[model samples]
Target: MADTEFVIEPGRQDLVMIRMFDAPPDVVFRAITDPELIPRWWGPHVLTTRVDRMEVRPGGRWRYVNVDAHGREWAFSGVYHAVVPPERYVRTWEFEGAPEEVALETVTLTEVDGRTRYVAQSVHPSVEARDAIVRADGPRGGRESMDRLAVLLGTVADM
Candidate 1:
């Protein structure tokens, strides 16, 4: 149970998130791509997440919604561009609330000494759109999600 730390770097038109997990690359990859496991760690603790549709393959479409305690839902949808099992994945992300804003995201996982380093790079349409995501607490939520993912991986390991 080491401290789960994530580095978030924001650029003019992109954001990069780096995190280390005490697990293998395959485990980390499954936690992210598996619809069953996604709800366990995809969002902050205060919200409940559900993956309505998940097809992890090229040209596949996916959608998930997060519901707050008050039952308000925040939905997100995306299209998969590439899926490299246990290593890399590329997709487009869009929040239903902000239909015009979209980001192309690439997630790469590397393993070293039984630990995996997870990196997610997101390129937005513009700097303003990128900054807006950060200002909206995207980093905070991402960090929380990683923390939860770490815990979930630990629990899964024991099972």
Candidate 2:
């Protein structure tokens, strides 16, 4: 498997566009959907996460708690908008720390040859919300999460 890599771009939607990973689409999908596999790869590489509840179907809700270095525990909850096996999924997300800032996410996976290209889109309600997240270096945390995912996959994707 190749390591997960991503590029973040600022846009009208306050989008975080990324081209990541060189793993099988199923593997990447598993990283997103499997409760047992999630916390191991979920969150900024520096933060630790624990899945409180995860149900991966439309209307199913998922909850998680992330603890930062300062021992601050942040709680996040969301409902799954859609889930279709190992190909794609969409969900609505919000953190307790920022209730006004909701994030709608769409994740797509594709496999070429022996590798999978993973893309995730996060749409915020406002440009200000988007800018706030990016300026906070959101993807750095995501990068760490992906690195954890790579580790859980048993190996990093090809860097």
Candidate 3:
């Protein structure tokens, strides 16, 4: 498989990230939604993730925290709007620090020739909010996170 190229495109009030994985849709989907697997690859390498709560079902609530090496924690929470295993999921995402700036995120996984194309679209309440996420180096973090996911998937495959 080729190297995964992560692309982040910002629209009027939304941001889209595209990444290709060497694994199938089911594998990639589990990597994202599985609570135990999430702590292994959800954040940057410099941080440790803690899943406070994760319920992957319609109307379910989830929360997670990532603590950097320095012990500074960043927390995020969301509510699942829809869940279609190995295919798509929609949720409302909110950073605990800025809860008012919530975004509706939809993640889709499509398998093509045994590979999965993962697309995440985050629709913010306003253009400025979406731009703020971009300015916060969200793209870099996202790219790194996905790269980590690939490595985790390799290990999961072995298991």
Error of 2 at 2 (Å): 6.2
Please provide, for model 2 over 40-132, each residue's C-alpha lDDT reduced to its tens digit, 9 standing for 90 to 100: 788877678899999999999999999888998989899999998788999988877899899998888787785666678888898788778
lDDT of each: 0.89, 0.77, 0.87
How high is the lDDT of residue 128 in model 1? 87
Which candidate leads in TM-score? Answer: 1
Best by lDDT: 1
Model 1 compared with the native: what TM-score?
0.93
Taking the tens digit of each residue's C-alpha lDDT, what string does model 3 give over 19-134?
88888999899889989988888877778999999999999999999998789999999999999998999999988999999999999999989889889999999989988988
Give each model's clash number.
0, 7, 0
lDDT of 1 by residue, 1-159 (tens): 255444445557888888888889988898899999999999888899999999999999999999998999999999999999899999999989998998999999999789998889989898889889888999888889988998998889742
Clashing pairs in 3: none
lDDT for 8 in candidate 3 is 45
Give per-residue lDDT, candidate 1, residue 156: 92
Candidate 2 global lDDT: 0.77
Selected candidate, larger TM-score, 1 vs 2: 1
On TM-score, who's better, 2 or 3?
3
Model 1: runs farther than 4 Å from truth? 1-11
